[model samples]
Target: MRRPVLATLIAAAAASALLAGCGAPAAGDAASAAGTEPGSATTPAVAGEITVLAAASLTEAFTTLGRQFEAAHPGASITFSFGPSSGLATQITEGAPVDVFASASTATMDDVVAAGAAAAPAVFADNVMEIAVPASNPAGVTALADLARPEVKVALCQPAVPCGAGAASVLAAAGLTVTPVTLEADVKATLTKVVLGEVDAGVVYATDVLAAGDTVTGIEIPADVNAATSYPIASLAASKNPHLAKAFVDYVLSGDGASVLTAAGFRRP
Candidate 1:
């Protein structure tokens, strides 16, 4: 990261009419009024299909949850679209057929909430940044500060994405300057660059390294540079089946979803 950061805005593509970009609830009273106890309402399996748009980082975890939800609610078929949080928000706001949305950052979530396309979104988990490098450790990056050295070729996520934004905060705190070969659109892409040795080092989530296991090695970041990123989930206000959407959101907030996300490297929000 440099003294001044460039902000990138991602755009959504044309999807099915049922699919628009994600939007947030109305301000003040409407937001509060929309908030409800998870699973408080009856969540019968009302059917067409339940589509979920989530951040790219949640790909693995949500895929697992989607399977479990399908098994539990046999008639319900689920579809998922994962990418940068900003991109997902754009799709949802554009009227994507998203019944639910799970964002990697609150800022992105706020965009959806403010658009009045979603009910109040509740934060479920938080994630922190880490350095993902090849198992060989050729560059010998030991801490957040080391990326500043001119010899290091780093790859960071785009600022609009959660990991990219966290990297900015950490690098600023470390007083480091990184001339990265590129800034990726999402965290997984950055991690992939490290796994492929396309870059000497890349910033990602601690959980991603854990999931990759032997594929990549993780270097710890200083506690201060560890900015906890919040993940928020909500039922879309444009939902065709808000009742089922609410139930799915409840499942994600329940012990079942937490178990999967935590095991994958997310912390309680």
Candidate 2:
């Protein structure tokens, strides 16, 4: 009778051990199922795509910075729409799904801020107007006054654009008048006319001339007569990726970004 009781106890112990072994997951497996490593917590990756509406003058620098941003955050990416600041501002107010806006001037940015499309923007850079002529300079243009010659064909941005406004200011300061052969939608368009020799010269930002490299020659306006514009950046209020948008903005304001901008011939604020 004692041996029979002992056998039954042994059988019960074996059954209990089997159930315990089969019922519960191992500690490592439980941790993994909970989305963590057994001994460490994981950080959420900075991952998402964002669209940035930037001034045409920022094309080169911003493109470089965007690449850097993506490389720094493995799962993140950026798409850029480069255009006149005024047009971009209008797009933002019209509910375009842009994550960030980088304006060539404060006035254009103010329009967005006033519309509640964006908040207070930080000025990141300053740029002055320059006269970009074709490499050949067919009109023999040398000074700002040369643009005033009635025979010279000139290209200017539309009045609504920041580059246009800056050019206007510089002309006004110098007490000179110029009639452009064509009014372009943006600085790049104006520069293109000069590059293609469609116009004798184009009034554009100094940075635009720098970007053109060997394709164009830049004539500097006198400091006393030159006009400058401030570049401001903001994250749009309706951004689908707000965190990533803000990160890009902050990155532009960082030292790393400053170096790139400086290399691109932009003046820091």
Candidate 3:
């Protein structure tokens, strides 16, 4: 018989189990059900932990995903180290205890693949760039072209990040050069500038704006600019819980994960 359920928030923790040398591939999928191990019952506390190093832009969606994973598989703990994809890659190369590395840019993951720190990575979701403006619209910025004005204080991520690269593409396609007041290390930082009213305008992923929940208004850039963004995830070479890692990664591409990402305004890759 199924045990009585508790007050689990679904996105709270992760479930870890011991089943060496068995089961299906869970790479790039983050959603796994309880009893993933052989003969394992849906126990209240399976007791396992998986560490994930992800890009800064994925902070919200992944956090939601984490909570869901924890709820589905009770007794599991998921720890995340979210930051710029490049920084995460460097940490992995330097031998961090990272079971999964989800990069905002393929180039960053290439570094991990080059150093043999992670297995083959896969692109899971795609994001499009948008104009993030203050909730009050103090600058009167309405369109992508408006960002070219002198009075608009803009912000963009450092060029090493995926969102930054996409921002450059958008500017070049429109033949516009924005003198951003700040070049943040990650997309989330850039978005924060607009949300905090520190900048009149900024560029960020469409998903970022949605995740912010009305803290900022988003204007669609161009479809071509959207063409350049992608999110890739992989399993690290040094993992104590690889089976669980794969389960999480695989969940990322499943229908449940796709729905969460879509609701957050990210497109399927």
Against the reference, the lDDT scores of all candidates come to 0.84, 0.92, 0.83
Model 2 clashing residue pairs (backbone):
none
lDDT of 1 by residue, 1-269 (tens): 43323222122233332253334333444444544334433334444588899888898999999889888887678888888999889998998878999999999999898999886889999998888889997899887777888888899999888889999988888777787889999998998999999888998988888888998989988897677789999999888877678878898999999999999999987
Q: Which stretches of candidate 1 lie over 4 Å from their true place?
A: 1-47
lDDT of 2 by residue, 32-142 (tens): 776567855452345799999999999999999999999998889999999999989999999999999999989899999999999979999999999999999999999
From the highest TM-score down, the ranking of the candidates is 2, 1, 3
Model 2 alpha-carbon miss at residue 264, Å? 0.5
For model 3 the TM-score comes to 0.81
RMSD of 3: 14.2
**TM-score head-to-head 1 vs 2, winner:** 2
TM-score of each: 0.82, 0.84, 0.81
Which of the two, 2 or 3, has more lDDT? Answer: 2
Estimate the lDDT of model 3. Answer: 0.83
| Tens-digit lDDT track of model 3 for 194-269 | 9899999989888888888788988888675444567889988898887778878988878899888888788888
Candidate 3, residue 115: how far the Cα is off, in Å: 0.9
Return the lDDT, model 1, position 32: 47
Candidates 1 and 3 compared by lDDT, better number:
1
